[model samples]
Structure formats: C-alpha cells, structure tokens
Target: MPLDGQLSTLNRVYKDKDAQDVLEHALNNFGDMALVSSFGAESVVLLHMAAQINPDVPVLFIDTEMLFAETLEYQRDVAAQLGLTDVRAIRAKRETLFEKDNENLLHLHDTDACCALRKTEPLQRALQGFDGWVSGRKRVQGGDRQALEYFEIERPLGRLPRAKVNPLAHWDRDDLQDYIKAHNLPRHPLVAKGYPSVGCSPCTTKVKTGEDARAGRWRDQSKTECGIHFGANGAVRAS
Candidate 1:
C-alpha cells in the first residue's frame, strides 16, 4: 500500500484510541521508529509510556546548545528514571553552528534561521533511516497544532517521506496533568516556576497567569514553533 493509504488506515483505527494504544500501533507498524522528546513539562507522560513498552526504543533529544540548564538536567533525570537506554542526544555540527551563529545571537536576529540551524536541520539529520517518529505534540496546545493527528506523513526537504506519530494529539491540558499524576512521573523542574512550555533558554520565558501554556516560548515574538515539525500534505500549519 502507498504511504497515504497506510497513514489513513492507522489513523482510522487508532485516532480515538488510548494514547498508549496509538503508540503501540505505531511502534509495531512503523519500522525503526524513534520518539523525539523535549523533556519539557509534559514530556514525561510520553517518555514513561514509551518506557513501559520498550526501554530501549530510541528517544531522540535535540540539544540545541541554547537550552536551559534545567532542561538538560531534566532530560538526564527522566531518561535515567525511565531506564531508557537508547536515548540519543542530537546536536548540530560545531562548524555549522559557528558559521550560522558565531556569537550565539542568531535568535536575536532571526528566530526562524536560528531554529533552522539548531533544531530543525539537526533533527532531520538524526531522523535518517527511521521509518517514523513519535512526538508529544497535542491539540490542546492550540494554533497550528490544533489540528494534529495520531498519524500523518512528513516529507521534509532532502529527507525520505515518513510518518509523524503524535499519540497525544487529542489530549487536553487536564488530560496531560491527570496522566502525569496517575503515573507518578518525574516533572520538569521549570514547571513549578511558571515555565509551562520549555524550549531553548534564550527564547523561552515564564508563562504569565491566564496565558496559554506556550505563551512563554518566543515571548513578544511572532514565532511559536521551533520549526522541527511540518509536512508536505498541508496538515502542519506552523507560522
């Protein structure tokens, strides 16, 4: 079957099922799958689930070198607590990093370009040979992600078309918290300090009361996403 046909079948069957069921189906059907995680406030829910199924499943972490120290620590602590042996830290080449952001101020100049070199490009490289990838994106986050799906095809430039599995696409904020509580999962330290959505250090800020979970990210700027995800099928609405 073609890629679209397979994607449709998977979505049709697992779209409304439990998140773990969706993840399991993706793992069993998509060969060489990897789970990309930020180890952010709500990341432990998925990481814990993945750990339950297979501790060795590759969990890709994009270390943009601009992340907060707490995020780095959380990444280590979460992986250890979950016994994820195959967790891989993905980073951009030093040479390219210097060429693009020699002063480490590309984000000050152009957030998109900074994310391109740091997060998006490096993750694309790390995803090579993987038939699909799992992410913690949720529709509750809103904006472009409000329409996310359990399964969709991604055709990044210069990369093979693959599946982007978002098991939490339909989960709401309450649902995430409930899961985290029910499982007694490790929490990102920043969450207690108002950083509901953690990203790179320079870009992320503490969310103010009554603001969205992601309002802190790229605060005062038009940018929301780090540009790590998108697809050719027009489902991804990043901007």
Candidate 2:
C-alpha cells in the first residue's frame, strides 16, 4: 500500500483514542507484531503495556555494543520486571564491523556510515519475519519527526511487507512522564542524571536544563536521525 493510504487507515481506525490505546489495539490485532525499544527514559511505559496485554509480544532491543552498561542492565531488568518473554537483543555482526571499518573510526569521521553499520543494518535484519514493528518515537521530539503519523509503510523485509507503528507519535514528553509515574514503572537511571535521550555511550552526553531532549545525542554534529526510519530515497517521515 502507498504510505498515504496506510496513514489514512491508521488515522481512521485509531483517531478516537490516544496514542497508548492505538498501541494496545495494534498489538491486540497483530499477534505477530514486535516493539523496538531502546529502553530509554520513558520506555518502561510501553514495555509494561505490552507485557500487560501480551507478555509474549516480541520486544526487539538493538544493543549496539557501544551502548552504556547502564542501558544493557536496564534492558534486562525492565524486561524481567515486566515479564516480557520475547525481548531479543540485536547486535551488529562482528565480521561486518571489521570488514567495513577496521579502525572503528566510522562514528568519528562519518557518523551516517557508522549508524548504518551499527544501528540500521542490524535492526533491518532483526525486524525480519514480523508483519509490523512498533517504535517509541513521539512527535514532540521535533526536528524531522514533528509531523509523525500513527502508522507508516516501511520497506519490506525479506518477502514480507512490513508496517511501522508509531503509537506514541503524537504524544509529548509530559505525557510520557505521566504514564510512567501513573503506572509506577521503573526508569532508566541516567534520566535523573540529565540525559533525557540516550544512545551509544560514545556519542551521548547529558543535556543542559533548557536544552532539547535530543541534544544529548550526537552532540557535536548536526545529525538528528540515524537513517533507519527514513525512506530509501532519504526522505524522513515525521517520527
């Protein structure tokens, strides 16, 4: 289906409820769907929701290997706490990394290439076999994602045509925090240390008081996205 058609379908079906309701409905309708979570600040809410509705729902975690130890620990802890049975940690192939950039200087000289190798490619491989995948992205994050929709037609993986569901696309940071608190969910420890958005340890840092939530990521660069969510033609759909 065309992207516009997919978006229209989602908007029509999920227009009545908030983003969370849309997410729950997606999981309920598509039994084989998976949620791709970074286990960042407010990730606990979605993880908890999925576990409550279906503990068996697959939760794909892209462990870039360069991520902070805290993130890995939190991923395991949160999954265990929520009783999420299908959490899979995806990683870049060692051979691919060695062959493409022997010095591992990809992120230093060319961040786009580095993200492709470490994040995009691995996630593409991990998403295979699923009819659709869910993301924790929200529109309020702004930048290239300000106009994000609830659903998008992602590139097909293997022989399967896949959909990317952004259930929280229209939510703001405050909503995320409220959900987490209302549910009494655990938070990523670094969030209290001023890191609103977390990514690879080498590229992430703590943000200032009034800085954008995403400012901590790729601090020295102008890059906002890692390119996996963009079209093959390099156009970024909102969220």
Candidate 3:
C-alpha cells in the first residue's frame, strides 16, 4: 500500500475507539508491527493491552545501558506476566560509543550527540524491516507533544521512512492509572518513590508537587527529548 493510503486507513481506525482498541486493530492489520516500550511508570498498561490482543507481537525494549535497575526488573516482570513472546532488547554498539565519544561524558556537553549514540542509533537499527511501530506517548505528557496524533510517519532507523503509530495519544494520566489498576498490572517501583516519569538513571529525578509529570527527566536542562522520533529536518513530533 502507498504510505498515504496506509496513513488514512490508520487514522480512520484510530478515530473509531479508545487507545487499546486502536492498538489491537493496528496489530491485527499489520502482523509485523511492534510496540516500543520504555517500561517506565504506566508503561505496563500498553504492554498488557498489546499482550492481551496478541502476545506474539514484537515488543522492542531499548536497553540504553544507563537505565535504572528497577526499570529493567519491571520490564522483565511485566513481559513474563503478560506472556509477550518477542521482547527484543535493543542495545548500543560498543565500538561506536568508544570511537565516537570516548569520554562517556557526552550527555553533559552534548546531549543530542550522546542520545544519537546511545538511544536513537540503537532504536533506529532495531526498527529495521518493520513496516510500522507503536509508542506509548500520550498528548498529556506535555512539551511539544501536547497536540499528538494517533498516527504519523517516521523514518525507521532515522532513514527509511515509514508509518508510526501512537495508540495512546489521546489518553491522559488518570486513564492510564485506571487501566493499570483495573487490570492489576505491576507498577514501576520508582513510581511509589515519587518519580512519576522515569528515564535513564542519571537524567531522571523525582517530580515535585504541582509540577508536570515529566519535569523530572533531564531536569534543569533545555532538553525535552532524546531526539529519536524527530523528522529528517530536525522537527520534534507533537507529544
């Protein structure tokens, strides 16, 4: 199918129901589709939803080699409980890391470069051969993503452009919590410790009262995202 036709079909399906149904429909239509997960707070909801519909759908888990131990544990636990069959762990290339940025302090001086090496580069590689992928992003997450759409085109591996689906784009924080609670899904351990938004160990912190959930990630920095899902012209996608 042409990319435009695919986009139109996805948009029509996504407009028909809530996030979970859209996700299931996407997986049903595109058998090769996968879900990209960070396994952070509230991540299990989507993971469980995907598992319920199709346990064999590939679940791409990016292990940046800098995530919290609790996050890793939660990832494994959720995958097992949900019976997800294809939980592929994507990782950065050691040679690229050593040769490109030997100091390992690239994030401090150049976060974009560091993310390109650690997060974006690996994810781009993992997305190879996929027709499309799903993300847990919601509009309420704030930042430039405040006006997110259910479906958009993405350049897989940051090169070969393809359709990208955000099934939970319309869901809010309360909706997520309710889904998890109703399903009795396991929560990320750090959430109870006040870290509403979990990312890498070094970059994430606990959120303060009245602050946005994602404020803790890359605190005090101008950084909003790791730059993986942007356009070729360097425009960030709507959250």
Candidate 4:
C-alpha cells in the first residue's frame, strides 16, 4: 500500500477508536505482527489488552543486558500472569558486544552508539519475520511524541520498512492507571520506587518531583529516547 493511502485508511478507521480497537485492526490486517513491550511502567495495560484480544500474539521484549534485574523478573511475571503465549526475548549478540564494547562503558563516551548496539540492532534482527509491530507509546509522554498517531511507519537500519502500531497513542497516565487497577494487572516493580520510565540501569534514574515522566532516562544527556521508536530526529515518515 502507498504511504498516504495507508495513513488515510488508518486515520479514517481508527480516529475515534480505542487502544484495544487499534490492536484488533493490526492483528486482523497483518499476517505477521507482534507486540513489542518493555514491560516498563504502564506497559502492563497494553499487554493485558493484547492478551484479552489474543494471548498468542508474539510479544517482543528487548533485554539490553544492562537492564535492572527487576525488569527481567517483571518480564517473566507479567507474561506468566497474562498467559502470553509467545514472549520473545530479543538481545544483542554477545560477539558484537565483546568486540565493540567489552568494557561495557560505551554509554559514557557515546550514548547513541550504546543504544544502537544494545537495542536498535537486536530489535531489527528479531523483527525480520514480522510485517508490523505494536508499541505502547503515548502522546502524553511529550516531546516529539506529542502528535503521535495510532499507526505510523518505521524503517529500521538495513531492514524493510514496516507498520508501527501505537495502540495507546491517545491514552494518558490516568487511563493507564485506571485500566491496570480495574484489571488488577501486575505493575513493574521499579515504578513504585520512582522510576516512571525504566530502561538500562546505568542510564535510567528516578524522575524528580514536577519533572517529565521520561526525564529520568539518560538523565543528564539530551537524549530522550533509546533510538528504537523513531529516528535520531524523532520522526518516522510513512513508508
């Protein structure tokens, strides 16, 4: 499908639909689709909704090897609790890390490079078989995401462009909180400790009072994302 045509169809069909409706459209339309989850704060809401729609949908979770142990545990717990049948753990190649970042201090000199290696590369490889994938990003997170849409397009490095579905693009914190509480979904352990957004341990810090929800990630740096969702400029053009 042409880019504008796809966008037109998506906007027309899902402009007023909810997150669950968006997931249903993606799952029904795409032969190969997966749900990418960080199992981070508020991640459970999407996971729970996906499980309700189809527990067998593949759920991709990237393990950067630098993530907190609690995240790993939470990944397991959430999948088990939701009865998610296909929770795939995507990881960076050991050899690549050994050769390029044996000291494990890449983030200090170059934050973008570290994320590209630990995150973007691995996810691209894992997604080769899928035509579209789901994300939990929302407009309320701010920054470049303030105008997020229900469905966008992404072209990962050296891979074919694919549809990126953000089911919760229109959802907010209170919507997520209420859904989780109503469904009794399990929360990521670190959220209670002040980490509104969780990622690799060394780079993630707690968001201070009155700070942006994502302010803690790469705390001192200008980097707002881990280079997985969008390009360096935080723009994903239609494919």
Candidate 5:
C-alpha cells in the first residue's frame, strides 16, 4: 500500500485505542522501526513504553552536541534504567561541522541552518536504512502538533517518505505525568528548572509561569521544529 493509504488504515483501525496499542501495532508491522527521541522532559514516557514492548528496539538519540549536559545524562540514565539495548547516539560528521559550523555559533546567526547542519542532516543519515520511525509528539503540545495523527508520512527531502508513528498524539500533559509516575520513570533534570520543552541549550530558555510549555524554545523566534521532522506544518511533504 502507499504511505498515505497505510496511514489512513492505521489511524482508522486504532482511532479510539490507547497509545500502547498503537505503539505495539507499529512495532509489529514496521520492520526495523527506530524510536527517534529527544529524551527531554516527556520522552521517558514513550521510552518506557517502548522498553516494555521491546527493550532492544532501536532508539536514535540525536546528539546535536549543543544540548544541555543534563539532557545527555538523562539519555544515558533512561536507556540504562529501561534496559534499552540499542540506544544509538547520532551526530553530524566532525568534518561537516568544521566546514559549516566550526565556531558552533551558527545558531546565533541562522537557527535553521544550524539545525540542518547539526540535526536534520545527521538524523536523516542515521535513519537511511530504516523503514519508518516513532516519535513522542503529542497533540496537546499545540501549534503544528495540534493536527497530529496516529501515523503520518515524513519526507526528509531527497529521500522516500518514511512512516512516522505518533502514538501519543492524543495524550495530554497530565497523561504523561501520570504514566511517568506510575512507571517510576526518571524525569529530566532541567524540567525542575522550568524548561518544559527542552532542546539545544543555546536555543532553549526557561519558561515562565502561565506560559506555553514550549514558549522557551527559540525564545523570541518563530521557529518550532528543528527541521529533521519535515516541512512547515510539521512533516507533510511531496512523495
């Protein structure tokens, strides 16, 4: 079946089912599907879920090298605690960085370009052999995420569209917390400091009370995604 057709059938079949059911279905059908995680504030929930289903499921952690030290530590701790065997650390080639962002100051000038060099490009290369992947995106996050579905197509430009499974599309903030608490999942250290939506340290700020959880990302900028997911509106693209 075509990517769109597969998405339609999957979403319809699992429309009212819980996130676990959807995740299990994806793991069974999508051969060699990787779980691409930021391992940020809410990542441990999905990480735990995937661990329960299959501890060895490949987890791709994009190490932008610009991330907070806490995020790096959390990634290691979560994988160890959950027994995730194949947690891959993906990063841009050192040569690429030397050519494009030697100073690591590209973010200070062009955020998108910096992301392309450090995030989107590296992730795409790491995902080359996979049939599809999973993400922890939830609809309650708002903005481009509000219209997310159980399954969607992610075209990484120049490559074939890959199946992107979003099992947590319908889950809310409380749902994540409840799951974490129930599972005794370890929380990311930065979350206690008010960085609700954690990203690269240079681009992330502390969110104030009453502000959107993601308000801290890119601070005063209009950018949301790091471009690894897809085009504007978040990942829809030409096949």
Candidate 6:
C-alpha cells in the first residue's frame, strides 16, 4: 500500500485509540516493526507500554557516542527494568566518525553535520531489515512536531523509506507523568537536575523555569532536531 493510504487507514483505525492501543495495532500489523527510542526524560512511558504488550519487540537505541553518561546508564537500567529482551544499541562507525568529526567538535561549528555523521547515518544502517518503526515524538514537544500524526513516513538518509509510527503524538507532559507514576516507571536521572529534554552531552543543557521543555537541547542553535525525523514533504529534516 502507498504511504498516504497506510497513514489514512492507520489513523482511521487507531485515531481515537490511546498510545498503547496504537502501538499494539502497529506491532501486529507491521511484522518487522521496531521502536526507535532515545531513552530520554519521557522514554520510559513508551518502553514500559511496549514491554507490557510484547517484551520481545525490537527496541533500537541510538548511542550517539556524545550522549550523557546518565542517558547511557538510563538506557541499560530501563531496558532491564522493562525486561525488553531485544534492545539493540546502534552506534556510529569509527571510520565515519574519524572522517567527519575527528576532533568531536563538529557540533560546535555544524550540529547538523555532526548529527548526520553520528545519529542519522547509523540509524539508517541499523534499520535496514525493518519495514516499520515507532518513535516517541509528541505534539506537545513543539515546533514542527506540533502537527505530528499517529502515523507517518520517515525518509532516512541512505535508506529506503519506511513507515514511522508516533504512538504518543498527542500525549502531553501530564499524561506521561501520570502513566509513569501509575506504572512506577523509572525516569532518566537528569530529569531532576532540570534537564527536561536530554540528548547529546554537549548539546543538552538545563531548561529554565519558564522555558520550553526542549529549550535545553541544542541551546543557542537553530537546530531543533538531530536530522532523524522526516518532514511532511518526505524529506529528511536534518536539523
């Protein structure tokens, strides 16, 4: 089926359904589906829900090599707590890193290029055999994602287009907090230190009291995303 048709059907069927329902439906429909998670502040909500439905579902975690030590530890702890047996840690190739960012300071001059070298490229390679994947993006996150849908298509770099499912597209911070509290899920360690949104170590900062949740990420930069999510026009919005 075409991308639009697939999106329309998926939205129609799972439109009013909650995140868990959308996830369950997607996992059953897309046999080779996987969950691509950052394991950031609110990642545990989706991970826990997925574990409840299918603990064996493939969960892909991108370790950008520049991520905070807390995030790395959280990834391991959350996976074990959720009993997610198929959590795969994807990393950037050493050769590619050496060629693109030999000094690891590429993010200082060009965050997009650094992300392309570390995140987008590696994820594209890791998703080779999957027909579809789920992301934890939410409309409340702001910017381009404010209009996010339950189902979409991601045109990743150097990879065939694949179905991208955003099960928590409509969820808000309160909804996530409630879910986590209800389930007794563990949160990323940095959350308490005011890092509402965690990404790479250098790029991520602490959000102030009145700032947006994601204001800390890539602070003082025009780059909103790390070149992973796709735009509505089927282009990779690598920034």
lDDT of each: 0.87, 0.81, 0.82, 0.86, 0.89, 0.87
Full ranking by TM-score = 1, 5, 6, 4, 3, 2
Kindly report which residue pairs in candidate 1 clash with one another: none
What stretches of model 4 exceed 4 Å from their correct place? 1-4, 231-239
TM-score of each: 0.96, 0.91, 0.92, 0.94, 0.96, 0.95
Tens digit of lDDT per residue, candidate 4, span 198-224?
Answer: 989999999889998888988777777
Regions of candidate 2 where Cα sits further than 4 Å from its true position: 1-7, 156-161, 235-239
- Mind giving the per-residue lDDT tens digits that candidate 5 earns over 1-239? 88889898989999999999999999989887999999999999998999999999999999999999999889988899999999999999999999998988999999988888888888889999999999998899877778889998887657887899999999999999999899888999999999989999999999999999988988888787777777535442111
**Worst ten in a row by lDDT for model 6:** 230-239
lDDT of predicted model 4: 0.86
List model 1 lDDT by residue over 1-239, tens digit each. 99978898888877569999999888887899999998888999999999999899999999999999999999998899889999899999999988888899988989888888988888888998899999999888878777888998887876668998999999998999899889888789999999999999888888889998888888887777788887554223244
The CA lDDT at 30 in model 5 is 84
lDDT digits (tens) for residues 1-239 of candidate 6: 78768888888888899998999888988769989999999999989989999999999999988999999989999999899999999999998888888998998888888888888878878888999899999999877888888988776645677788999999999999999999999989999999999999989989999999989888887778887776755334433
TM-score: model 4 vs. ground truth: 0.94
| 230: Cα error in model 3, Å | 2.1
The residue ranges of model 6 lying beyond 4 angstroms of the native Cα positions read 232-239
The candidate scoring highest on lDDT is 5
Residue 16 of model 1, lDDT score: 64
- Deviation in Å, model 6, residue 71 alpha carbon: 1.0
- Residue 175 of model 5 has an lDDT of 94
Query: What's every prediction's RMSD, in angstroms?
Result: 1.6, 2.5, 2.0, 2.6, 2.4, 1.6
